[model samples]
Target: MPISSAMAVKASSRINSMFRILWLSAIVGMLAACGSVPLPPEPPIPTAPSAPRGAPPLATPEDGAPLPPARIQGRTRWQPVRWAELPGFTDDALNEAWNAWIRGCERPVPALARLCPEVRQLSIGTPEEQRAWMMQRLQPYRVEPLAGNESLLTGYYEPQLDASRMPTAAQQVPLYRPPADLATRRPWYSRQDIDTAPQARAALRGREIAYVADPLDALALQIQGSGRLRITEADGRVSNVRLAFAGSNEQPYRSVGGWLLQQGATRDASWPGIKAWARANPQRLNELLWSNPRVTFFREEPLSEFDAAFGPRGAQGVALTPGRSVAIEKDSLPYGTPLWLSSPGPLLNLNRLVFAQDTGTAIVGPLRADYFVGWGDQAGEVAGRLKQPLALWVLWPR
Candidate 1:
C-alpha cells in the first residue's frame, strides 16, 4: 500500500470533503424540525409610569362609558267609587254615626248601626251603594284603608278623646289653625318626661326608626313636629288633630323610617356619632329638609283638591281603566309601585294612576290593592264611590 506522496495527499483531501458534507446535512435536518414546532408569543410589558404610592385607583364606569338609561314601563287601571242614595246621609247625627263606623271601634259600631241602619244595610247592597255608604260612613272618621288589603287601614285616627266631650260642631273650630307652635314651647321633656325621653334615647341606640305613608307626607309630619295636626275638609272646613307621639319606650321606627333610609344615616352606621352630632346641633335636626312655604297643614282634611286631581281630564272620582292594571308575585312587589287599574264600572272613564307605595298593617295577602281618596269630604265621597270589584294592573318600567 506504499504509494507516491502526491497520491496520499489527494486521498486525504477527498476524505475531509466527505466529512464536511455529512455535518452540513445533519445541521439542515435539525433546522427543518425546529420550523415545524410552534413557539408561544411573549406577553407585553407596561410602558406607563407606576401609580403614585398609597393612592386608590379612581372609580369609573365599566368600559369607561356612562351607564344605560333606566327603562321603566307599566300601566294603571282606573278604580271608581259608587255613592249611596240613602236619605239623611248628610245629616249631623248620621255624620256622627258614619264617623263611628269608619273608626271601626267595637263600642261605636253597634251604636252607629242603631242610629244609621242604612250603613249596615248598604254594606251588603250593590257595590255602588256599598261604596257610597262606606264613604258617607267613613267621611267623618277620616280613615282610609291602605291599598292591597281589606283589613289594614292607613289613615290617621283622631287622638284619644278627652273626658269633657265637646259637640261635633264645637270640635270643628280648632281644626283650622296650625297646632300650637312647639318650637318656642319648652321641650315637653322634663327630667321626669319618661316616655318620649326613653324613645329619644333608644332612637340614638339604633332601636327606633322613622317611617311614613307617603314620602311627601313624611316631610309634612316632620315640619308639624309633635304637636297637633290640622286638616281642611272638602267643604272649606277645618279641624284640630291630636297626633300620637311615639311613646318614650315605644320606638318611632315606622314614622321616620323613610327619612332615615334617605339620609344614609343608620343606627348601625355610627349611632353614637349621630347622637353626638344631634346633641351638638338640636335646631338643625328639627328643621325639615322639604318644608314648603306655600303648603300649610289642612286641619279639617288630609288631602287637598290637588291630591284628588288625577287622569288626563281632572275627573271627579277614581277610575281604573282597562289595560292598565298589573299583578306581581308577592316576593317581587316593592312598596310605592304606581299602578293604573282598569275594571268594569258605571263610569266608562279611562283607567287612572295611583301610588302603590303604602302597605297596610293587615294588607299582607296577595292580589289586593288600596286606593287613596284625598282627605275629608272628597275623601269620603271617593271612598263611598269605590264599591265595584275591578282588576288592577301595576305599571312599572320595563
Candidate 2:
C-alpha cells in the first residue's frame, strides 16, 4: 500500500530540514577556519522525525523493559585522541543525539550505567551543556581495526508492508513464527525446504502470523530481521504491528544481491533493482530467493500509540533512534558506547554522534557499521543505497 500523503510530506520535510542544518554548519565551520568571523550561535537542534503514519510509539526506560546483557568491548585498538580531532564535534546537535544516548542508558554497560542519571538530566540541556559534559567525562579514542582495512558503512531499515490475517489470492506469501520443532532441528530447513519439503511445510502449518502479497516483501522483512506490518483483520478492522526477530534457520546467509551480480542478471542489486528484475522474470523469482539459505522467524507485537515514535527494539533491547542508532560488530565496540562517526559520503556526508545500540550478522570488523535509517519507503530507499567508507572514534567514559 502507498504511504499516506501526509506521512510522505512529513518525512520529506524532516529530511530536508536535517540537510539544511548540515549544510549551514559546514559553511560556519569553513568561515571559522578562515577567521572571517567568530562562530555564530549553534544551529537549532533538530527534533526526532515523526513516527510513520499508524506506526507504534516508542517505549521508554520508565517502562522498566527487560534488557539483554551488554556486550563486552572488543580487541580493536583505541588510539586516544584529543576532542579537537573529532570533526563537527561542536556543530552536532547533542540534544538530538541525547535521545539515543538516553535509550542506550536503558541497558548501559556497567561502567556507563552509573552516569545515566546525569545523562537523563542533560536531555533538556543545550548543545553546549551536553557537549561540555561529554568532553569533561568522556575520553575520545580513534578506533583502529586489527585487520587494517578501511572501515565500511552500510545502512539497514525496518521494512514496512501491508498484510492480511489470512492468505488471499493476492497475499499468498506467509511470514512464519518459529516452527514447533524449530529448536529440535539444528540448522533448520533452508528457504527451499520450507517451500518444497512436505515435512517442512507440515511443521509450519498453522504457524503463519500474517500473509503478504509479494514474496520479495517477505524476503526483505526476513533480511532486515524485523519490520512493521499494517494488517487487515478478518472482520475488516485494520491494525499495525511489529514482527520482531525470534529465531532463524541455522543455515548461513547467502546474499541474493551477490548472487544476482554473479549471474550478470542485473548491475543494480538493490531492492528496487531486484524487484524490477523480478517483474521481468517472475519465473525465476523462487530461484533468486532460495539463493539465500537462511530463514528468520519472528514474533508479533502489537503497536500501541505510545510505542509508535521509535523503530523496533534492536539487539540492545531499546527502541532505535532513526538517525542516531547503529548496529556495530560487538567485537569492535560494546553496546551503548558513544562514537564520533565521520563518513565522507557519496549518498550523505555524515559527521555526527551515534550510539552502538545494535548488531547485525554482516556487520563485522572495527570500521564496519550498519546505520539504521528508520522505517517507511523513504528510509528504505536510503538504506538500500548506502554503502560508504566510514571512520569511527569511540567516546568512552574517562
Maximum-lDDT candidate = 2
Q: Which stretches of candidate 2 lie over 4 Å from their true place?
A: 1-73
lDDT of 1 by residue, 140-197 (tens): 1111223443321122111112111122433421111222332332332221232236
Residues 7-80 of candidate 2: C-alpha lDDT, one tens digit per residue? 32333334323333443344433332341122233334334455567665422211233322322347577877
Clashes of each: 70, 7
Give the true-structure RMSD of model 2. Answer: 15.2
**Local distance difference test, candidate 1:** 0.29
Native-to-model Cα distance after best TM-score fit, residue 13 in candidate 2, in Å = 36
| Candidate with best TM-score | 2
Model 2 compared with the native: what TM-score? 0.81
